[model samples]
Target: MDERISCILSSLKKAKLTPKFRESEIIQLENIRSATMEDISSVHSTSYISSREQVMAEEAVLGHLEHDELIKDW
Candidate 1:
């Protein structure tokens, strides 16, 4: 995920879409707390998150299968 985010940032930089931030402005905080279920449920239902997870899992499996087919063709 970090690599993907870096790739996106690099692409944006190449396109001159993202403004360069100062080194001082880029703060990497440590030990950040994750949001609780109650906090998340305030905005989205647990069922909705579960459904989205299912969809993403299905898409990932389909993508893997497609990649495998392409490899076989090669």
Candidate 2:
């Protein structure tokens, strides 16, 4: 067996048992993918998203950003 798979199986065997995993755990995993663009827009204003995109683009071109400046804004 692959080392990774063996390690994972061993870990699983060692895990403490509890009540069986619930249906909610499955539902949460199914929604792990990102929300649609419309969903994102609904949460954040369109203008804010556009401005954030521009800032990220500029940072990519510059190759580095000022950490303190970014944290201060946050």
Candidate 3:
């Protein structure tokens, strides 16, 4: 198993032993509804979605640039 995955599993195991989990305070979603773009726009304005998309695109570009720089350094 990947070190990161093992660490995450270990963390989850530890979390289950906490008082919050023991008391069943956390709500876990059993069934998830698959939402369409129309469903999304119904909740959020078109302009808000557009701005969020732009910010996400900018972040993706920056992440790639940072990754490329790291590779170059190596």
- Which lDDT value does model 2 have at 37? 86
Per residue, candidate 2 scores C-alpha lDDT tens digits across 1-74 of: 22453465456445622113333343334547767888889899989889767776876788764544432321
Better of 2 and 3 by lDDT: 3
Clashing residue pairs, backbone N/CA/C < 3 A, model 1: none
Worst 10 residues of 2 by lDDT: 16-25
lDDT of 3 by residue, 1-74 (tens): 22453476567667774334554664557889988889989999999889767765876866644433422322
User: What's the candidate order when arranged by decreasing TM-score?
Assistant: 3, 2, 1
Q: Provide TM-scores for the models.
A: 0.37, 0.40, 0.44
lDDT of each: 0.58, 0.55, 0.60
Residue 21 C-alpha lDDT in model 3: 56
Clashes of 2: 0
lDDT of 1 by residue, 20-74 (tens): 4344555667999988878878999889878756765876866644433422322
* TM value for model 2: 0.40
Considering summed lDDT, which 10 consecutive residues are worst modelled in model 3?
65-74
Clash count list over all predictions: 0, 0, 0
Off by over 4 Å in 3: 1-24, 64-74
As a whole number from 0 to 100, the lDDT of residue 44 in candidate 1 is 96
lDDT of 2 at 71: 26
